[model samples]
Target: MGMRNHELVPLQLIAVIASLKHGGCHKVLRELVRYKLVAYDATARRKSSNNEGYRLTNLGYDYLALKALSSRDAIYSVGNQIGVGKESDVYIVANENDEQMILKLHRLGRTCFRQLKNKREYLNHRQAS
Candidate 1:
């Protein structure tokens, strides 16, 4: 999911959440639900068996705001969008610590485990060569 400084729709926000490392999206959702950080959204439907829909609770919005701030720091203050790999866009970002880091924004729109594995192989080949 790509980051945008402005507000994001639920699906786009979900995409951003899903892009994080670890089971962060699920963890966040579970915690949010437990903490009542979410509200039922009548508009969004759960089309896919794997994904369910909910609106952010007040706390959820705060969390998303923080994420947006972080993403803005990464994109604006640091290096701009540099390159697009097969599955992700690579950006060079400087954190508050002033350390340069690579932000790999996954293209969740086209993400699949099978395709990811194949792309990993390609990356490995390039690195090895």
Candidate 2:
């Protein structure tokens, strides 16, 4: 629930980290997996680890990070969009003390993903021609 690691975490380790009941944690994990927030690998040795477990997907990480930021008074309510760029979304957000702040969601990774998709399609068409 806290630490963010690329390595797969065993269920037992997760229970220990979150200090939650095993049964409840299992149910919650199932829900998260269903929502595509968590990715579960049944096969071990994928990451050269003997234990198979779950890890947060990119979406899950983003959700957790935003939640943490909100809890820490980094952002309060979101207002209208102030500006945006090709790889980011800028919005006016407020802090706990009602101070306005500019929150930018930098989606630079998505830009690369989009470019890859476009290039792949273009290549396929070129091959046909």
* TM-score of every candidate: 0.31, 0.57
Candidate 2, residue 124: CA error in Å? 36
TM-score of 2: 0.57
lDDT of 2 by residue, 5-75 (tens): 42477788888888879998899899999999888976665366565788777668657767988988788
| lDDT tens per residue, model 1, 1-129 | 222221223544675656754456667666777888675444422265343356554456545644895876643344778998766667777777778877666563254755434444323333322
lDDT of each: 0.54, 0.71
Candidate 2 all-Cα RMSD = 8.7
Inter-residue clash pairs, candidate 1: 37-57
Whole-structure CA lDDT of model 1: 0.54
